[model samples]
Structures are given as structure tokens and as C-alpha cells.
Target: MPDLAQSTFILPQDATLTSEQSALEQRIWAFINDNHNTTSTHLLIISGDAGAGKSVVLDAAFAQLQKAARATSGELAGTDNKLLVNHNEMLKIYKEIAGTKSYFRKKDFMKPTPFINAYRKAGKRADVVLIDEGHLLLTMPDPYNKFRGHNQLADILQLARVVVLVFDFHQLVKLKSFWTPALLKRVTRDYAVTHYHLTEQMRVGDAAVNDWIDHFVRGKMLPLPHPQHFDFQVFSDGQPMYDLIQRRDAETGLSRMVATADYPFTVLGGKTWYVQAGSLRLPWDKINFTDRPWAQRPETLHEVGSIYTIQGFDLNYAGVILGPSLGYDPSKDRLTVDLAQYQDKEAFKKRPDLADTTDAKAAIIMNAINILLKRAKHGLYLYAADPALRQRLLQLAK
Candidate 1:
């Protein structure tokens, strides 16, 4: 069996914006502050690939907003000043608010309309409204009419002189209409949008890892290996990866370990140990339902085949059981792209220019693997169940 130690948590640092970015932030802030008189709506949508420091830039911008708010005494003349961060922290804040109400509970916070409206109403004097994970607003399946079309979160954007939706559309792929061509056109056409393509690699500590991710995403990516001790093995089989994860060396934290989240899904036998299902879920609830055994099963039984469960998250050492669905052809030593499995295939198809971008697909998988690999501070063990693939990995190791 493949073995990999449990991975550790990565606390992202605040990204520092350059002077040019500072100017843009200042301009956006000024527009927000001046909105009361302008009566014109302003929307600023920030898009980037995952791990491109999108959150860091937003954090910096929000920090500026806080400073400006304190300096101007929170009254931006005609602007309504507000800042909302998504991710785990936003959920926590919502939970606290839900606790005060009889009808609202911790679980109800996922439908964040009540909490959002309340926050907006209280911060009327504010001119700028920022939603870090604004994409989530679009995906929310709430029956509440307030979240509809113009009355929806877009209304809040209209209310504020300046509204910022800081997001990586890549992460929102699970949502419908996330990266649709029409939506892409709207983003490019509407508002004074600024495209900040972060070319630097900071998240991955190793240069090879960074280079590999770039190469995987956009095949043209050049390697920039670090001098650090590291090894990469490509296997024809899937079992060896599992064996590596299970390998333990007590001297180093390299000893085998297993990690679990407060969320569901158990890691067993060097692969994600979760109940099987025919399809995956959308948000948190999706995983809960899909894990039900009563759900239809595919002709073949392989656990690590789904990228939806694997992407955007990491494990200490991953024994990825490359399934046929992903078009893993060992003889060719090349991977094929399949858009059907995409979280938002319709949206992806709408962006026809990206239709042939193999880099984008590889980058997604490589990045997911990177997330899993980085979880190992010591070493990563590669394994494949197929004996030929396992032997290939062993040969690659040498």
C-alpha cells in the first residue's frame, strides 16, 4: 500500500502590492469615497489563477480601507465603507451573528443573506464594499428573493460608490456561470478593470515544484529548480505512491502520519478514504451526500480518480490512483485533457480560446499534486498500484 505522512496547514501571508497597485488601490478608494455625489455605480473585479496572491492583494487593499476609514472617521462623505472576507474566517463571523438570532443557527450561516444585509445596513456611511470571495455569492442556492438579480449582491455593489469582488475564478469553477464566456466578456467590458498577472512563484517553497506547476499549467513553463534536496518519480503503477506514504523514518518527522479535518472524508491506505459516489457535490453539502453508498457506482472502482475531491486542497503524501477517465496512458508518457469533468464545464467551454490549452489542465492537476506534495516537509513518496507503473516509478527514482 502507498504511504504518505499527514500534511500541515499553510497559513498564507499578506501579499504586498507594488507602487502601481498602490495607485490603483488609491484611485479605487477615491472613487468609492467620491461616490455619494457621482451617483454612478463602480465594480472592481480582481481575477487571477489560484495561488497567485489574489487574497494577499485584497488584504492589502482592505488594510488601506481600514486606515482610510480611521483617518476620515469612517464617513467617506458619500461612500459606504464595508469589508467582508470569505474563506473560513467569514464563516466564523457569520456563525457568531447567527447565534444571536432564534431562527439563524451555525448551519444557516451558509445562506449568508440575512447576515450580509444586516452588515450592509449597519455600515451605511461606508462608500466602499469589498467581498473577498465574492464568487460564492453567485453560487449560493438560497430561496430568499433578496439575493435575486438586481436585488442581489449586485445591488450592494450599486449602493456603494466602489465595490470590489476579489476572487480567483479558477476556485469558483464548481459554481455555475463562474467562468462562462459571457461572464468573461462582462468582466472585461464592465468597470475600470485591472489585470494583475502574478508571474512570481512564492507559495511553493521549492523552485522545481514551482517550475513543475507552471509547466503543468502552461506546458511552456521553464524549470527553475532550487538547490534543495528533492526527488520526483513518475510511475506507471499507482501502488508505489501508497507505499511511499506509509514509509516511516522516526528520526525525521518523515515517520508515516495520517491527517484528518473537522470535515468528512477519511484518509486510509495512502489514499482519501471516503464513501464512493457516482458524482461529486457543489459546496460542503455536496461531499456529504455523494459519500452515500446508495448512490450509483461506476463499472470501475478507483478512489483517487476525481480531481474535484483532490483539487484546491492538499495531503501530506498522495498516492494518486490515475484512472482511465483522466486518460492516463503509461506507454505514451503523456496526459490527455478532458473538459467534461470540469466543475463548470459549460463555463469553461464558453471560453473557447482556452479550449485547447493543455497547460491549463496540466497546471490544475500539477497544482493539486503540488498542494499534496508540499504537505510533506521531509519527503514525498510516489506510488502506483499497477506493477508496471510501480516499476517505472522505481526506475524513475534512480
Candidate 2:
């Protein structure tokens, strides 16, 4: 297997931080400096919505911490003393900004028994661990992870002296993800936990567009009262929407098509179902891992991506396909989800209390759609799979 820490990509230094980001960076530094030599563990949770600039703040902090560690000739004055874990694509971005020497996946850090055993064998423990997309941290045990812990968060807290987690609870789209306020409090009972919030929008510039997105994602059936600066459109068909995206990509770059897993497809054997919008037929792209970037690849333009591939990334324009699973009630003027048409197998697994109830399932589907809708920075082009829904969107567009 290839070493995960080694990367050739480097992020440009021109990314500027907003005021909120600058304040958060100072606080993170203060937290690290205060707890540098603490015997017990400390946890700092930075919570923010999408486009809140968590990654940018952390990237800047990482660079500063690295510089500080280099200047000091102490036990923690090196890269090995700190560890950074995130999704593969996120880590790649960080690698470009900070370089690759201390990167690991969340799964690798969650196997506490093995991680600790190896560390003990080497006679060292990590001083700090930085986690991005902390909501995506898994709690479920699998064949590869035989860790003796309740969840990944617990295991990570045990392995490091100080842990910094950047998370957004709303982005919890997976079944096994273990990020809730109650869960966080329960797991961090033994550690000193500090919470910080990031509020400024960094990805989408228009506040009206953000508000409209929030309203739509919350299952509002009302028509969007057009925003001033954002460019949002609803198309009757998918081909024109895709054409707009392709044109935008050619002109400005970072535009792609994404959708929910409403169609039938095989994960293995490289089989895929086509998303048809009138004369348009496009293959749905399989779920790509954190290491493999679907949106950044040129071939992805010809494919439709799911929430898994496009989440945590920003685009200039996004062409979204609201598949058959999600529908519109013309009589009620509200959004509805058909549980039967929903095809995300992992999302179908429900908690014992919510078993057999469509409420939870519907919420997940809506959340997935919300995430897809908010991905575009400057523009959003949408096409509903159901004719009724398409007609409704068209009426709203007019």
C-alpha cells in the first residue's frame, strides 16, 4: 500500500481569511498553547455550517503551529508530535497548503487498541490530533477495526493529549456517523471540552441565496423570491441544465452535476444507471472515496455525482437532478419523498426507535438534497425527475 502521508499537491497561499476565521485561529492557538503539557486530554470543538471557513482557518492554524514547533527545541517541536486526520480529498487540500508528513484517515485513528499498542511499542504518544469533517467520524465497528471502544471519538480522545475537531452536525448524512451534541457531551465527560462557532459564509456570497437554500432544504414548498446577486434557475429538462454547467465550467471552471441515489445502480462491477432528462442520458458516477476526487476530475463532467462525492467541496455552478425519490405535491405546494424509490441502502438502516417509519428516511433524503442544492457558489441549476415536480419548479421559475 502507498504511504498516505506523502502528497505532491500544494495549495496556493492566496486564500484569504475572513474576520471570523482570524479570531478562531487565535483561539485555537491559545488552546494548544495552554494545554501543551497537560497530562489529561483536552477537546476543542469548532462547529460551523457549510462554507463557514473551518478548513481555511484550520489550514492557516496548522501552518502557524508547524512554524512554532520548528522554532522551539522541545519534545513537541516536530511534525511527528501532531497528527492531522480528515477525508482523503480534504487532506490533499491541506497537503497542498501545509505539505504531507502527518496525515491519517479517521479510520486509522479510530482503532485505538492497535494505535495505542503501536505507540506504546515505540514509546511515544501523539501530542495533538486535528480532525476535519468530524461529523463523518464513524462509530460502527468493522472487520478491519477491532478497537475496544464505544466510538471513534472515544478512541481518538484516548490516543492524544489534545484534540481539535472541526464539525457541522447538519452534515451528518451517513448512518454510522457519530456526531450529536448529546453524544459529544457523553464522550467528553472526562476531558475539558470547549466549543467555538463560525458564522460567516465563505463559499456562497449572497445571503439571500443561502436563506433560500435553507428554506428549501427544510421542506418548504413555497416559491423562491429571487435573490439579488445569486444566479439560480430551475429547468424543465436536465440537458439544458447540464449544458449551462458545461458552459460555466469551460468559462470559469469548478462546475459539475450532482444528485441523490434515487436510481438503481451496482456499486461493484462498474455498472451504473443512466439519469435521463428528455433527450439527455448521463451515467451516474459511483461513490468516490476521500482520496479519489470526483469533482476535480475532467471525466466527472460526463457523470452525475452523489452527495458523498460532492459534499465538503464548493463549485462555481452546480446542475442538480432531483430524482424520482423526491417529488412535489402540486395540490399542497410542498415537497414529498417516496420512500419506495429511495435507493441509498446505508441510509435505509434505521435506529431501533425509528425503524419502519418514513419520517427519518424522508428527513435523510431531504438533507441530502439540501446539501446538493447548496454546493454551488455563484449559480444553481435544478431539474426535477418527476414531471409534476418539474412543472412546479417551472412555475416557480416564471
Candidate 3:
């Protein structure tokens, strides 16, 4: 049994809150303050699209709440609040950003069953639980969880009085995710539910590029008119694309090559299989979670990244590879997904539960690709393994 109580919470860097974020924070705070002593549970859902500053807002708000708890010795005082997240990389990033400030107890949402069991054994429940990236919450039992549960959200609700979930619907890329808005509403029907929407574009540097990314992800195949400020481009060759990413990384800081999980991955002597496209072969990034994280480590620049590794963070330049799974049909002038060629075994394993039909599987793949496409802050570089898609992108570039 892992010690759930022996964790430290770090506030994210650049903890400044926007006006909209501040308003949402106040609402959540008011709910926590009002319901801390009550026998009733409350649920607050903060909804936003990617780069809408959900994490920043939530981090800042939690810090303030913790401070208030200490100053006035209110209802939150001595309360065992926990910050829950699905990814370890994301937690590490939060710790890096926060430095030394203590926020709350932190735990992975995937291990909820164990945590809940421990709490039940101890005869206690957390007063407040803040779930970051709540969309990644898993419902199915995996190797890590031996306890039975139908939905993670329901289990979490049983463990905390005031549950704060910060999530984006589009970010639910995993097959086992059961945190849909409809499901959330259904599960939290008895609790006091409050919703807040964040709409500002904070990550992407170019608004036009961001709009194009939105339309692209939504299956709108309209040709993108070239933007003046954004450094978006398509490469016919993979070597030059990799070189460009390297140059950008050296100059402007974070730049990475991200691709859909199209190729088969194999670990040979602790090294990931090299991604190959004709003569351009590059080693895929090592699966670094602890010691050296994927985003912060400089050596990761030499390898390719996936949606899982780079989703929550922003990069200066993103070199995107649309693998064989996704293609462009010149005749139809539309993007197409080949479910048969999709190589992400874990994602495909959950296909039966996530999507019953072929079309549904394709849509899921497109969503994954969309996440990779939107990771770039100032620039987007592209290379499609499918020849037709490559040609189509080149045409659009012209």
C-alpha cells in the first residue's frame, strides 16, 4: 500500500489568474467555504478548450484557498485536501513550476481504487479534492487497480465533500475515460453542481493558426489560407523537417517532433525503436517519467514525441507526422482515417468500448492527431507518411 498522505503539492509557476479565472476561483472558493462544514457534497466543473488556461487558473485558485485556510483558520483549516491528476509527467511539471510552496496532498487518479480503500480502512474521507485534467480519469480496472469500480468519477465523489474538476472534453483521448459532461451531470445529480467556462486563447501565439487548428480538429477540411505571423509549414522530406525542429529548438527553446501512434514501438536494450520514413530515421524519445522528464530534458529534442508525452505542455515548434492511419483524399478533398492501419494497441484495445463502428474509431484517431497538432505555441511543422496527405498539405501551403 502506497502512502497517499505522504505527498507534497507544488503550485504551478506563473500563478497569475486572469479576470475570468479569478471569477471562477471565487465561485469555487465560496462553494468550499460554504459547504466545508455541511454534511452535503458539492461538485464544481471548470470547462475549457485546450490552452484556455484551466491548469493555471486551478493552480492559482488552490494556492489562494490554501493560504486562506491558514490565515483565518476557517473551515478549510486542517482539512486534508488532495490534488489528483492522471499523469505523472503533468505532476512533475507542476512541481517544477511551483518550486517549494506546499499546496495539498497529491495523488494519481489512476490509483483511486487503492486510495479510496485506504481511506475507508482509515475511516476518513478527504474534505476537498481538486482533480486536474479530469477528462483523463479512467473508469475501467487495469493492472494498477485490483479493486472494482464502474466509474472513477463516482468513486471520487464518494471520497470527498467538495470536488473540483478542471477538464476539457476534447482532451479525453484515452479509451477508458468516463468523464463526459453527460456522465458527470448524471453522476453528480444529487450534489450541488456549478459550471464555469474558460474561453481565452493563452497558449498558441497566433489566433488565426489556433482557429485553423480548431477547424481542422472538428473535421472541417477547408483549405487554410496562409497566415502572416504563424510559422506553419509542410515538408515533403523528413530530414529537413527534423533539421528545422532542431534549429528552432536551439534558438527559441522548446521544439519537438510529435506524431500519431502509427508505427509499432519496440524497446531494444532500453532504446525505443527508431521512427523511419524512407532514409530519414530518428530514434523515438525514451519513455522518461522520473529523473529526467520528457518535456524538460534537452536530449528529448533528438527524438519523436507522442500525444501522451506532450499533451499538457506547450512547445515553441511542433513537427507533426500524420502517419499511415490518417490520409488526405485528393478526389474528396477531405481527411481520412484508416482504422486498420492505426498502430496504437492500447487505444485500439478499448475500441470495442469506445466505438462500435469503424467510423467511430477513425474519429478517435483524428482526435488524437488533433491534440498533437495543437501543441505548438508559435509554429507548426508537418510531414505526413501518407503520400496523398503530404501532397494535399503541400498544395494547401501554396
Candidate 4:
């Protein structure tokens, strides 16, 4: 599917960004323009909180680069193969670029294709390489030495002349770094970073709503207004939330129903459900149907769409379960969610309770929730068992 079709990639431009964000974007542009003439190794890492316009700026910058490179095609300094890593949108770009129905279904291992092996070998330089949700590129191994994903993009990272990694620190899930403080730390230490903090949020309609999500993602999120169409409501009886979910669910009829780390069912009626992976496999014979197709009876459940899947997707209604993952941490003097276990298999083996750090996971979870909730043409519903959680919801809606 195309990134435009995906809910995550198709960002709505409803609100204007703040002066700070605009300044940051200009600075980044200047840096790129200044280095546009340089032949030295150019790597730019753009980091921001979720909902900040990293992708938005990237879209504009990429378009400019494509225009410039195309204008100076033959006389330019680099190859015509401008490699772009589109995550879920990769297939879309390839289809559009090739302008044909092409599928990688063949089992032949040796013979390489033009589109397939653009960056297959080392010293294979390209005008530029762009990676989205870039944190996924970093995958370190545990003591077991097991690999994460088969596509070891080490070659692509090393080969690209001008490589750009765009991502949010809050969304770092199961990153692999060798003795680094955090994924961002590793990147900043390695490259001549041109930091751009995207503060103005265009996702949530209200400034208060943006602030709520920002705080959930980072510890402290300031209030910033957004454009219209971004609106939300938190319901106590589940009626408001459920009704909204049902409407959207009726439209799609749960065909794209998904499970999350939170619950057994991908979606109940309209609202998406989530549960910790550890809890799903408990002795009660609790099975996880997350990311799987919907089953007939209780044993069959819908699959949880990864953050990448929902990047450009949205739901009519979204229900979030705090479960045992999040709690009030006195040390932080704020809500603390332990999400370290969500992606760490080894850590899960040691401490099972940290499996669902609800607070830490809140922003990403809620961001996913927003992906679903914003799909509503009419309304949105939110439910949290904890009273404080419920109150927080009220604050967001108001």
C-alpha cells in the first residue's frame, strides 16, 4: 500500500507550526543547502516528539532534492538511483516508479534486479537515501545472538552518500545499540547532527489535546493549539466511545480489525483492544490473536497492527486498556510507564510485570489510539480504569 493511503504517513495540514518549529525547519534547510555543494560525507538526523512535523518537513525537503537532482540529471555529481526506504510505503513507491505490476514472489536467490538491488553492494553510491521511522534500522542482539529482522540494512546505511534518518525519541521501541545511552545518543555521537525539534502539532485539533498527547509521550508537554477537525472526547460509561467505535466498525466491518500488545481481540465492536504479550499467554489459556486474522470463536482473535502498519491508517473509535502496565511512580513525580518489556524478550523473561508500562507506552499507544480515534467522522470515545487516567482523558477532551 502507498504511504499516502497509510494513516500514519498521510499527515493532515490543518494547523500552522510555532515560531520555534519554523525556525528549526529553516535552520535544517540552510544546513542542507549549505552542504548541497559539498562532496564530504553528509548525514542528517532529525529527531522530535511524535506528532511533531518531522515527516512534513521531510516531504518538502525530499521534493526539493528530487527536483534539483532531476534538473541537473546528467551534469550532476551522483548516480540517478535516488534510494528511498519508505517502510510500509516502500512497495507503493516501487510500483509507481516502475509503473507496472511487480511482485517479489520469485525464489531465485542469485540473479539481482535493478529495482530490487539498487543498494545491494558496497561503494554503490546514490544521490541520497531516506529512511522513515528510522529507529527500526538499529537492532542489537541479545546474548543469544539471534537476529531481529532478516533485512540487515547495514549495507544501505554505509553506502548512501547523503543518508537521512527521521524519527521520534518517544517512539523508540526495542532499539539495539552497542553500549549507547539511547538510540538518539548513538546517532548524535556518530554524525554531525542538525537537530530539528517539530513542536507545532497538526494532528490533534485542539491545543489542549496536543499537549495531552505530548505529555504522555514525553514527561512534560506544553499546550499548543491545532487546526480544526482534530477533536476528541472521553466517556465514562463507554457509551460515547463505544458508539463512535461501532459506527466506524460498521463501515469497515472489522475487516482490518487489529490486535495490540493490550488485549485478546483486535477490536471489540469498533474500539481496538490491547494487552501485554505476557498476559495473553497466561495459564488461563489466554491466547493472543494479535496480528492474526479474526477467528470464529474465542480462540481466534484479530492481529495487532504494528506502529508502522497504522502509520497512515485511522480508526473510528479507540479503546485503551491501562491494565497493569502503568502506575504512579513517586520517583518521577509523574506517571511512569514501563515499556522496556514490550519489545525486549529477554527482559520479559526476568521481570514480567514491567511488560506493560502503561504510562511510558501511553503516548505511542494513545498515538495509535489517535490514529483510530481520528478516523471518526462524528465522534471519539476513550476509557481508562484508573480514576486519574479517566481525569486525564477529561482534561484532553476539554
Candidate 5:
């Protein structure tokens, strides 16, 4: 977890940011200053793939916002600002960070559903609501998740004068949170809009290696990068990959082994489930109850991580098992996904707009791998379960 903790440390204050650094600052302030009976919410949608510093930007914005809210006198004085994120593990981390700061409070960081429900019930609106990981916001009603609204973002927009969302559509994993640019445009059709795409990658700092991962995620299997500083290993077997991950963890902690959703496991089934590959056997990460995140816990070394556990968190190193749903096409020189082989049925739940098309399903699967592969800040170790994929990847490394 030190790997993640190292990344989450708050950076320089916005007040100290250089003129060249504040790309989103001017627009953020304009919306705050130009508020005069906004019939439609002023929408600031910031998009980036994972590791693009969206969360860090949102955190900096929130810091400045809270300071403004605490100001003695001004147009911005005594204004309310709340930060929201749909992911529970991330929410917990935010709260933990708040615990150390006197000015920050846990109540200020909240899940979207409760924030929306409370505001609607009280007939009030927030001044500025910054949503981190906004892509995880529910697109449809889900009682199990306690989100009964038709759409969470739409609801938040109604409940806030200005909504700043840190989003990445590629991070969409579940059908409940299915989103596309078209859908986003439809949602904000009438809003006064400002948008930004963060291109600077923060976690995976090696650009060449990062590009190689990007190509693979998009189905173009190219030669693995040969960056002298970044470690990229292709394992023909799983056990050796696991061993390397352990060594890396022992050296620097917070390195992990994760897998694609190509194996079967049920939530709350009263039975332990395992992910096995050639002498490498480990249980799926159990439902975490402790305050620590799945990656932070010491016991998780024996458990294989999932997209749910690893997303939005950085690792010192990541040992990834590309499960059976994926194959390498040596002839096509790319990756292929078999939706039928994917075990995460929850991700393929019905979406009215998407219907039964496998395109969305395939993209979701690839996106999961993309997020998994990007979690490592220092290195990435890969093991493909499909023999053809393993061989192809190994050949490319040579």
C-alpha cells in the first residue's frame, strides 16, 4: 500500500501552481465567479485514461475550494464544496487522509448516492461538487448499490450549481455504470460546458513502455518495449511471475499479482475460489473488511487481485495473469477477446442502449486489462494463460 500511499500524497497547493500548470484552473474559477441563477449546471468534464492525474487534479481543486469556503469575506466566502467519488475503497482512502488534516472533514468526502439523496431531501444545492472517478457513477437505477436515481451524474448536476467531474470512459467496467461520449453529450446537451483531457501520465512514467501497453490494450500486439529503467517481464508460467512479484514486494512493498476476469468466482458463496495457472494457485482477493485497501493488506499477497481491487490504485509492481478470455493472433499480430470465455457476468449486465452487442463487452474486458496493466508504477510482469498468447508475447520480448 505504500506504493499507493506514495502516489496519493497531496502535491503543491493550487495557489503555488505555475501559469503553465493550471490548465483546468481558469475555467474552474470562471464557473465559480460567473454563477448568476444557472438554469442548467455549469459542467466541467475532465477526461483521461487511468494514471492521467485526474484524481490528483480533483484533490487540488477541492483543497482550494475548501479554503475558499473557509474564507472570512468575499464573493467565495462561506460557500459549500463537497467531493464525491463512486468507489468505496477510494472513498475510504480519502476519509483516511482527511483524518490527519484539521481543516478537512470526513463528511465533506462522500459517496454520490447519499449526497444526492440528502440534497434532494433537504431541497438544497451544493456550490461546487467535484466528483472523482465519475465514470463509476451509476447510469441506471440499482437498489442493491443504493442508487435509485435514473442516473447519478444527472442527479448530481441538478443538485449542484457547478459539477466538476474527473472521468475516463475506458474505466467503465459494470453495466450499471455504462457510459459513452455520445451518452455524456446527451446528458450535458443543455449545460454550459467546459472540458479537458489530461494527457500527462503520472503512474506509468515510461512513455515507450506505456505506448506498448496502449497498443496491446487496443488489440495491436507489438514488440514489448526495451526501456532500460522500467522492468517488463513476460512469463511463460505463472509461478515464476508470482515469485518475482513477491521479491519486488519484499523489496518495496505494495507490488501485487492480479488477473483478468477469465475465471469463475461468486460473491458471498461461503466457499473460497481459486485462480490457477501451471503450479501457480491463489485465491481471489477476499471481500476486504479491514480499513486497509485490498492492496494495502499484508494477507493479500496470497490472493489474486481483480480490477475491482486494483483500479485507481498504483502498485510498485504488477504481476498480471492474462486469463483465458484473451488470445494472441500471431497472423493478425494482435490480441483477441472471447466474450463467452469471460467470467465476470456482472460486467455484461443488460444496458438498454447497448443491447446484446458483444462490442461493448469486448471493450469492457480490454479496458479491465488496460487498467490492470497500468497499475504498476515501477514495473509490469505479464503471464498469459493462453499458450498462443504467452508464446506470442514472449517472442515479441526477444
Candidate 6:
């Protein structure tokens, strides 16, 4: 357990933007104003890596949109605008941010499914719609999510005059919501399309270490560079790392341990479950019953988080416990993934049209690792379940 108490809500970053971010927001605003009443729809795809400040830019631009929607004058005056996100945890954070602002309403933020279904039934179209974590939008009918539409993005395009989407290819983790750059291009080919690729890296502070992480995510095993502005450490054992994370949590706040879903557990098992590796043992992130995110919850210090709860969020120091599904192939002198060891079956669900599921399975697991590894803004703590993999990372750390 950590010295930090059960948590308070971590609000979105302040509404300030760098010059580059502000210029992008200005372009987005102009597009919305220009197309709000146009006969044809338009799309602006904001592409970036994780922690590239795409969400931050969107929030700033959306604040201006909301202001115009409720205003009495101006081109955007009385126009309708909505913010959409497919991730529940992220949705909670956005709505919380809305609730705190006088000009904003919680209702302005919603999931893509309900928003699409409601507006279509009401025979209404929006002036503009902004989607965060657009990579998570269902690309096919997912009846379980109450989304029976062929594709959520397509549905939104039909119901909006202008659509702005925050997308990252590396964040695609599930077969149902799988997306690729080619697929994105094909979908918006008929629309008046523009793209803004964010160049800034907002989370990790060190450039060399950031490069190492990028190579790791792409399956190119190489030496880890010595970091100047970042704290990067590798641990052969998880328990000691857990202690350091707890200490960091006490000093800095918002620090927690998160792992890939490589252990045996089910959401409906109706029993207490734990993640155990050697002498390190702890419960998985508790089923989040509060509005605060799993990492923001005070009790989460004692619980290991998963991709479901931690994606699209940031922390001061993220203690990453690499799980069993990942390993190293010393023979091939590279990293490897064992799909059988991956515990999240939902991520590997059969997609009828998906070719090369084997490759995709490995990619999804690596994607989860990428999301976990980049959560820390200042430092990162690390542990690996497989001894061979741990040894490989240790060698690279040297």
C-alpha cells in the first residue's frame, strides 16, 4: 500500500496551450465555423503518438466551441457541438472537466454509441463533433456495446457537418475497434479531409529514453539510453520496485503500479483475484465503482491497474510490471509474445475479416505494453515476469 490516501479526481490539464497547440486549435475552430452550415461534411484527423497532447488541444478547442454554442453572436453562435470518446474512464474525466466549467455541461460529453443512436432517432445533425481516443471507436457492429451500426466513425460523419478525431495507430488494442492508417484514409476519402500530425511529445521528458520506448513498442530490441531528464529503472524483482513506487506515490502523488492482463482472472469470477510474481503479490485494480479513475482512487495504491483503467491518462511515476504474455527469444535475438499467456480474451476475439490474427495478437499485447510504459510523465519503474525477458531488459538498461 502507498502512503497516499484514496484519491481525488485528476482533472484535465489546464486550458493553456503552447503556440503550436494554439495554432492547431485556431485551424480547428476555423474549420468548424466554415463548415457548420455547409452542404458537405468535413474531417480533420489529428494524428499523434500517445501523450502527444492531442487531447489537451481538443479540450481547449472544444471549450471555445462550447462557448460559441451557448453564445448570442458570432458565426459559431447557437451552433451545436459535442465531445465524444469511446473510453469510459476517459469519458468520466472529460465530463468531470465539463462539470467544473460554468459555460460547459456534462451532457456535452458522451460515448459515440448513445450519441449516434439518439441524434439519428431525433432526426438532428450536429454542427461539429470531436472524438478523443477515436482509435477505440468500434469499426464494426458490436451489439454488446449497444452499437449495432456498421462503424461508429461512419455514423458520426453522417450526422455531423464537421468531425475532428484524435487518433494514434499504436493505441489500437482490440479486434473490434481495430484501425489502421489506410483504413482511416479510405473512410474519409469522400469528405473534405485535412490532417494535423502533432510533433510534440508531452509525457516522458527525456528524448533518448523516448526513442528507446518507441523501438521497444515496435519490437526492435536495443540498448536503453541513459536518461537525463527522466528516471528509468529496470528491476529483476517486482516487490522492491513496488516499494519505490509507493514512495514515489507518497512524495509526488498519482503514482501506481499497472500491468498487462497476463494473469488468470475474469470480470465475473465473483472472487478476490491477485497478481503474483515471486514475492510480489497484490490485487488487480479494483472494479472502479467511483467516478474517480482507478489510478486516482486511494485504494488503487494496493491494486495493480490494467489498460482498461489507465489508458489516455498520465501519472507522476508509473511502475510497470510486465506480465507473462511477453517474453524474449534469445535464439532470434528479439522479443516475442505468447498469445496463450495473454489473459484478456476480449482483446483477441475473432474478427471474421481479420487476416493474420497471430500477428495481430502479438501487436495488441505490445500495444498494451506501449500504453503502460508511457503513462509516466517524470519517471518509469519496470519489472518483467519472464526471467529471460527480464535479463534482456536488464542488459539493455546497462
Task: Compute each candidate's TM-score over C-alphas.
Answer: 0.54, 0.85, 0.89, 0.58, 0.93, 0.95
Clashing residue pairs in candidate 6 are 6-298, 7-298
Q: Model 4: runs farther than 4 Å from truth?
A: 1-39, 67-78, 81-86, 89-122, 141-157, 177-191, 217-230, 237-240, 248-260, 264-308, 312-324, 327-380, 385-398
Question: How many clashing residue pairs appear in each of the predictions shown?
Answer: 34, 3, 0, 30, 0, 2
lDDT of 3 by residue, 1-398 (tens): 21111111222343456788778778878878887776777888898877777877677667766666556466567776666777767766555444445543333222455666677778887888788888877756665455566677778888888889987777766566634557777888988887888988766777778787787776566555567767888899888998999999889877888788888785447756767654467777666756334755777888888877887777778888878877777677777777888777676555345455454456568778777877777889888898988887788778
lDDT of 1 by residue, 141-215 (tens): 334325433223544554455666665544543232234436544543645444434444333445666455445
Name the best candidate (by TM-score): 6
Comparison by TM-score, 2 against 3, better one: 3
TM-score, candidate number 6? 0.95
Report the candidate with higher TM-score, 4 versus 6: 6
lDDT of 4 by residue, 206-270 (tens): 55555455465444423223336543555564334444444555564331223224433422255
Model 5, span 279-330: residue lDDT tens: 8999998877666788888889889999888888888899999999999777
lDDT (C-alpha, whole model) for all candidates: 0.41, 0.71, 0.72, 0.42, 0.83, 0.85
Deviation (Å) of 298 in candidate 3: 0.6
Q: lDDT of model 1 at residue 38?
A: 53
Go through the candidates in order and give the C-alpha RMSD of each one to the true structure: 10.0, 4.5, 4.6, 8.8, 2.5, 2.7
Best by lDDT: 6
Against the true structure, candidate 3 reaches a TM-score of 0.89
Q: Tell how far residue 177 is off in model 2, in angstroms.
A: 1.1
Task: Check candidate 3 and list the clashing pairs.
Answer: none
Deviating ranges (above 4 Å) for candidate 5: 1-4, 7-22, 25-30, 36-39
> What's the C-alpha lDDT at position 240 in model 3?
93
Q: Which ten residues in a row have the lowest lDDT in candidate 3?
A: 1-10
Candidate 2 vs 4: which has more lDDT: 2
> What is candidate 6's lDDT per residue for 82-160, written digit by digit as tens?
9999988878778777767877899899999999999999999998999999999998888888999878998899999
Error of 5 at 288 (Å): 1.6
Q: List candidate 2 segments past 4 Å from native.
A: 1-12, 72-76, 79-86, 95-124, 144-148, 286-292, 330-332, 350-359
